[model samples]
Target: MNKKTDLRVLRTNQSIRKAFYELIQEKGYEAITIQDIADRAMINRNTFYLHYQDKPDLLDRCVEELLEEIKNAIVQCPISMRPFSISTLETVMQTILEHISHNTSYYQAMLVGENKIYLFQSKMEKIIKDKLNEGWTSSQGKSTLKISKELLLEYLVSAFMGVIIWWIKNDLPLPVEEVSSQFSKIVAYGHFKAAGIAVEE
Candidate 1:
């Protein structure tokens, strides 16, 4: 589409998403409806439907946008910030921590209960797979590595999500950088240990 049309579509989608996010925060996924979103955005139900089939579709789109940005953040590691380094882990954690911190209002609205846990699982699964791929090789054979990788990925993602949820539920009294620094060390180093890789202190 032309630039003007693109901008219009973007603006409309943002309005709808902002409305949905606010309502979800005040209530929950189950309580939200297309009419509520339309009312909040001051748009007609037809306008809302033009962008999304329903509330869940809107949520999926929102989550997809968040994940795409997150993936870019992770993959665009600087040359000085190689993923193998502790400092690199800290950097990655810091980027995500900042995202979470900056969007505290949005997260504070929806990131609790099942929603929080779901976000954690969905976001970390790719990271876990990457880490697994990095450390595993053909020497371990496909079958063994496949099973081990899956199990490890599941465990680490669940553990990381659990920790974050606990921190959030406790009101996030600690500074995010501190919490994320410790998390990077604990998670990345712990993975090194699990994979029998030597850590340089």
Candidate 2:
């Protein structure tokens, strides 16, 4: 049946992805080949070709899948719980943190010796920007923020990405909830207060 075939294909793809991750960790991405992946995945080169055009295609799909998962998590977060509230932000942050934590090894591997940081940062910025645009548009002109939407998106994305990279590099010393809470506070209340910076009225 078509359903059974789909299931089998799914399993094959998962196996290939898992193998690719393991190989990347062990041998690095530049050193990996399709044959190597197929050997590790217990599939033939022809089977690998059937599923993916090449190793780069596989990597692209892997990153795309991660982005899709993150986007879905953000989209599914319940806005009605408390729209634009720190609690809601914390929930969203927690979802993101949990995803990163769950795939720590993969992230670590991807982030090293490459410009992959931009890949993640840009994708996250787009997702957050889209979400914020939705919120702003739905606010019925009641939202009053002095900053441009583009700048706000860049600032948020950069800040979050910096923290995430630092956390990952340090092996995530703090718990996800604690980090999320701290990040939410920093976003809700500017860091100038914590740093004792006086603002000119």
Candidate 3:
């Protein structure tokens, strides 16, 4: 009986999430109401209330689920192995790009629409920053850059977020692997190197 109840709950939540995503795509986040979501999901308003307090709460839950999915993908990628080298970075980018590509429509609705919901982006930044810090701390070799660790993390996170937003906004013109490769190359080789600036290490 407990197992059956859990299954029913899972199905209901999935329905609500699916309905919310569809509504966001059709009417945008700001314009979507709890009643609209309930209607689309074919559930009562009270059922929706039982699952979520309001629209923002529903959005938060959806974003949280996406974050978990991305984290899992990153963990499964070869990038999580060891030795934070250029290859590892490229793999990380590839994993992220693939995840984004897989959920392009949902990401487009949440991130690329005219009324973009920045909360999701902010949450992603937090997740990336935490993971980067963890990886750096646990890696065998530490970076010898003159910059502070915090500053480096901020730079990397900003660059990653910028690339993701750009890719989504442009409707992902280039393939995911190609974009990941280019981004990894740019990061691995500094702008000065690409610009013909000779700086001695």
Query: Per-residue lDDT for 24-69 in model 2, tens only?
Result: 7678777889988999899999999999999888888888888888
The positional error of residue 181 in candidate 2, measured at the CA in angstroms, is: 0.1
Colliding pairs, model 1: none
Which numbered prediction scores highest in lDDT against the true structure? Answer: 3
RMSD of each: 6.4, 3.8, 4.1
Question: What TM-score would every model get versus the actual structure?
Answer: 0.66, 0.76, 0.77
Give a tens-digit lDDT track for model 3, residues 118-182.
Answer: 88888888877776677766666657756787888898889888888899889898998888777
Which is the better candidate, 2 or 3, if ranked by lDDT? 3
The digit string of per-residue lDDT tens for model 1 on 1-201 reads 699999999899888878877887666778878899999998999999999988778877777777666667666643221224566546655665566666555555555654342663456566634633444441343443334656765775566556555666677767878876777677666757745778795
Candidate 1, 8: how far from true, in Å? 4.3
Q: How far is candidate 1 from the true structure (C-alpha RMSD, Å)?
A: 6.4
Residue 198 shift from truth in candidate 2, angstroms = 9.3
Spell out the clash pairs found in candidate 2.
Answer: none
In order, the Cα lDDT scores of the candidates are: 0.65, 0.76, 0.80
- Poorest stretch of ten by lDDT in candidate 1: 76-85
Ranking by lDDT: 3, 2, 1
Clashing pairs in 3: none
